[model samples]
Target: MSQDYDKILKENIEALILPLADKLLGLSLGRLEEIPDDIQTTLERRPDFLKRVISSNSHESYILHLEFQVKDKAAMLNRMLLYYAMLKEKYGESIKQYVVFMGRRKPRMSTQLKEGMIDYRFSLVDIHQLDYRKLLDDATQPEQAVLAILSNFKKSEVDTILPEILRKLQALTNNERKLRRYVRQLEILSNLRDLQKETIKHTEAMPITYNIEDDIRYQQGIKYRKRQRRKYRGNY
Candidate 1:
C-alpha cells in the first residue's frame, strides 16, 4: 500500500477506536470508562489508542494501550516492551496492552519478551479471527458497521454483507461530507480483505453529493502531489 493511504487508514482506525472504545475493549476487559486525553507518554511515543479505563464498578482503573499494525515489523516486540515500560513507569502495573493486527497474511509476530530477566507480554488480536457479524449487530454506532468490513467475513458472504454495510452507512448519515469520509474509510478497510472492488461499486452507487476537497484524505493527497512537483522542479 502507498504511504499516504497507510496513514489515512491508521488515522481513520484511530478515530473509530476512540468512539467505540467500550465495544472494542469489552471483548477482553468488559465494561470500562475511557479517560480521554490521558495517553501521553514520557518518551513522546504515543500508542495508537490509549485510555485510562475504569471498571463499571468504579473500583479498578487501568491504562489500556492499543496499537494497530498493518504488517509484522522487526523489533515490534521490543517496541511493545518499550511501551510497557513507559506506561508502567507512569501507571504502574495497572496497564494492559494489545496489538491489533490488520495485515492480510497470517500474523507471525511475537507477543512476549522473555529474556534473562524480562518476561513482559501483551495480547495480540488478529482481526480475521474475530466474528464481524458482532460488529454489524452493533447498530448504535456506524463506526462499528464500517469496521465490520475488516473483520472475518466468508468469501461467499461478501456480496451480501458488503452491500448491507454500505446501506447501513448511507442511512447513518445524510451530510455529504461525512458520508464521503465514511465511504472512503470503508473502501480503504475493505482492501484488508481484498474487497475493494465491491466496496467501490456500492459506494459509487450511493446518491450522496460530495466534493473531493471536503475530504481530509483528498486534501492530504493534493499536498503530497504539490510537494512531489516542487521536489521534481528542484531536482532539475
Candidate 2:
C-alpha cells in the first residue's frame, strides 16, 4: 500500500465497506481481493474513480462492480450514474453494479431521475449510523453481530465489550460460522493484544511484526465467526 492518505482510506474501506458489501449486498471478497482492475490506479489518487469488476456464480452467475467512497462529495449521484453507464457500456447490462458509501456521516442522496434509465443504483452504508453495542446485544443474531463488528467502531470499545460481544456473536448463518472461524485464526495470527503498553514495553526489546490494524480487524472478523460457530454448536 502507498504510504499516503489514499492508503489509509483504502485500508479503512477494506476493513469496513468490503464486509458491509458481503453482508448487505450478498457479495464476498478475499482480504486483498478488493483492488479493482478497471480503476486501480485512479482510486489510489483519491479521485472519484471506479472500484472493481468481478464475476460471480452465487445466484445467477453475474458480474460484481464495487465502489468504496470514504466521504461524500458533490454530484455523487451523477458520478454513480456515470459509473453505471460506463460499466454497462463496457461489460453489457448483465453485470450487477454495487456502490457503497461508508462515510462517517450519511449524506442526502437525490433520487435517480434519469429518463429511460434502468440500472442498479448505489447502496449507502453510513458507518456512524451503525450501532455496534446494539449488535452485541443481538449476538444471537450473528448477521447483525457481523455487521456490527464490520462496521466502524472504536478499537477501545471492542476490547471492553469483547466477552459479551463474543457471547452474542455465536449465532450466525452456516457460511457465517465458517467465516468466523477463519477470523479467529487471524486474531491468533496477528497477536494484537500484545500491543498493550505493558506488553509493548516488554516486547519493545524484541522484534514484533504485529500490526495493530491487522490484529484488530482479524479480531473483529474472528468475533463475528466465533459467534456464528457458537450458535451452530448450540452454546448460545
Candidate 3:
C-alpha cells in the first residue's frame, strides 16, 4: 500500500472499525474503551485496534481485537493466535479476534487452526461482500462515508454509486477544508477499486463547490481530461 493509503487507514479506521464490530460481529458494545495495542512479549506486536467492550444486553465484557487486513496472507491465522496468546495473558479476559479483509481480490486466508482438544478461530469479514448502501447510510462521520466505496457496490453502476457517496459526504461535512481532506481520502481509496477517474468525473458533475485549481488532484484530473480530448481529436 502507498504511504497515503496507510495514512488514511490509520487515521480513519476508528470510523470503520466500530460500525463493523456492531453490525457484522454482532458485538452489542455498550462501552468501548480503547486498549493499548502494543503487546510486549517475546516479540513485540501491535494490532490495528484493541478495545475492551461491554455487551449492552448481556452486560458481558471482553477484549475485542480487530485487524484491518489489506492482503490475504496465509499466516494470518498464526499471527492472530500469537496476538491471542499475548492479549489473553496480559488482560486475563475473554478475547474476540476479527480480521476485516479489504483487498480487491477474494480473501483466501485461513481463520482457524485446530489440534487435538485445541480449537481456535477468528471472524473474517470481506468488506467488499457488505452492502455499500447500508454502510453509507450507517456512516455518521465523513471518514466513514468515504469508506462506503470500499464495500460491496459492484452490483450498482459506478455512475450511480459515486454521486451518492459524494452527496452523502456533502451532507455529513460542513467545513470546506475538511471536505477537501475527505475528498482526497475518497480519491485515494477509489484508486484501489480503479474508480478514481469516475470519482473525479462525478464530483465535477455534482453541485458541491470547491476550488479545484487549488487542489493538485483536481488539477491533474483537469489535465487528464484535456489529454483525453486531444487523444479523441487525434483519433478522429
The model with the greatest lDDT is: 3
lDDT of 1 by residue, 45-71 (tens): 466777766666566778887877887
The clash count for each model shown is 0, 6, 0
RMSD to true structure for each model, in Å:
3.6, 15.2, 7.0
- The predicted structure with the larger TM-score, 2 or 3, is 3
Task: Give one digit per residue, the lDDT tens place, for model 3 in 46-127.
Answer: 6777889887777688998887877789989999999998889888999988998877788999888898987999989887
For residues 52-117, write the lDDT of model 2, one tens digit per residue: 434353433334555555546656677666656655666563555544554445666652555575
C-alpha TM-scores of all predictions:
0.80, 0.43, 0.81
For each candidate, the alpha-carbon lDDT, in order, equals 0.72, 0.46, 0.80
Error of 2 at 15 (Å): 8.0
Q: How well does model 1 score by local distance difference test?
A: 0.72
Show where candidate 3 strays beyond 4 Å.
Answer: 40-45, 204-236
Ranking by TM-score: 3, 1, 2
Q: Give the TM-score of candidate 2.
A: 0.43
Q: What order do candidates take by lDDT, descending?
A: 3, 1, 2
